[model samples]
Target: MKQYKLDFNSPIGIIEIVGSDTEVYSIMFSEHDQIVNVPQKDTPQVIIDCQQQLHEYFIGKRHEFTFSYTFEGTSFQKEVWTALTSVAYGETATYKKIAASIGNEQAVRAVGSANGKNHLSIVIPCHRIIGSNGTLTGYAGGMWRKEWLLQHEKWNSKGIKK
Candidate 1:
């Protein structure tokens, strides 16, 4: 695995990407900010590609990212995150939608809990999930940052399937 940091604004302060040869393993905000365990290791190919794609995303030139990645989570949590990635940029999905998508319509609270526990941030796009009431709610990055991100996607992002 290869790990590197890129400075980014909002939720995750400095972003860290853990990569393999083919795709990113994880993209997390440097919030808890655990330092890279080994800086001497070669930069992983996945990390390199992910950063390039992310640059395009921040610049509003990209929408969907194609990468082979795996996340470790409960089967239920994994389901939630998986559905989150399907949510197009600038679009928001309610917790209710996430629960239903995963075939557990009554699991809204569980879905919300899992969303909070998501170690991967933007790559998983957990920030794109909101309350069924159509309000921003329960973002691990802080709701204010969530609002900023959604608004940024809504306003700045182009070349997307709108």
Candidate 2:
């Protein structure tokens, strides 16, 4: 399988997206030259496409991501990830809501775990999920970044609460 990489400067931070056969396999935050399995082909088509979409997202021109992705995890985890993808850009949902959305209302804890394991981050909009009390809760990318992301989107969106 061919591999590819692209970097995006987002409001939160720089994100690196790695693709294989046009399907995104990993998306992680990067600060410096990290050990990323770079693309063998310079400016691969997939990488370019990813970078363009990311740029649109950061500028608030896009709300949804359209790309094939392979998220490796348990069935339950996959369910959580699938649910997370439905979270619209610049919107927020609760862990309990996400848990309930997956038809496992009693699995909030498991939902949190699976959410923490979300690799696709913003594309999957994992930061859009919050706590049951409307508080900024768990986020793998740090709560400060989460608040910044949400506030950024909120500011641009005119606080529609979407």
Candidate 3:
């Protein structure tokens, strides 16, 4: 299937949004300012919707996204991603909890691995997952971005200034 892409200049950095005409495939952080493959116009409706929702999210106006999205990964990864969505708007979950949630207590490491493989970023809430000791763990978008996102959600959830 032909894929369409759009870019959202978020507070952390430029987020590359990828999708088809019907569902979003992935949203990842871009390290460079260049527009590699995303288009400047003629974006798909799903991409446009994803962009708008992401804008709302960044501004603390949206806590949950309603845009159509699809997961393209292994079943285990999909299960880990699904468990992440239940982490709530301003809450965090440990990898061990996520593994237990999936009825695989021994998959804590596996959960972390699946998180790293997540295609969708903020929408999947992978940044909300942390280490068992309460320290921020690996985030595909970088540790600083993850910290910013967690702090953003904390303030927004409490109606406090960010």
**lDDT of all predictions:** 0.74, 0.79, 0.91
Name the candidate that leads on TM-score.
Answer: 3
Put down candidate 1 lDDT per residue, 36-75, tens digits, no spaces: 4333356555666667777777777677786667888898
Ranking by lDDT: 3, 2, 1
TM for every model, in the order presented, reads 0.81, 0.86, 0.94
Q: How many steric clashes does model 1 contain?
A: 0
Query: How many residue pairs collide in each prediction?
Result: 0, 0, 0
Off by over 4 Å in 1: 1-12, 32-41, 157-162
lDDT of 2 by residue, 1-162 (tens): 756777766666778888776688777787655444444556567666676777777776766777677889999999999998888666788999999998889999999999999888778788898999999887887889888889877776763332
N/CA/C clash count, model 2: 0
lDDT of 3 at 159: 88
Tens-digit per-residue lDDT, 61-90, candidate 3: 999989999998899999999999999888
State which candidate, 1 or 2, has the greater lDDT. Answer: 2
Model 3 regions more than 4 Å off: 34-41, 160-162
RMSD of each: 3.4, 3.1, 2.3
Clashes of 3: 0
lDDT of 3 at 38: 58
Sliding window of 10 residues with minimal summed lDDT for model 1: 3-12
Off by over 4 Å in 2: 33-42, 159-162
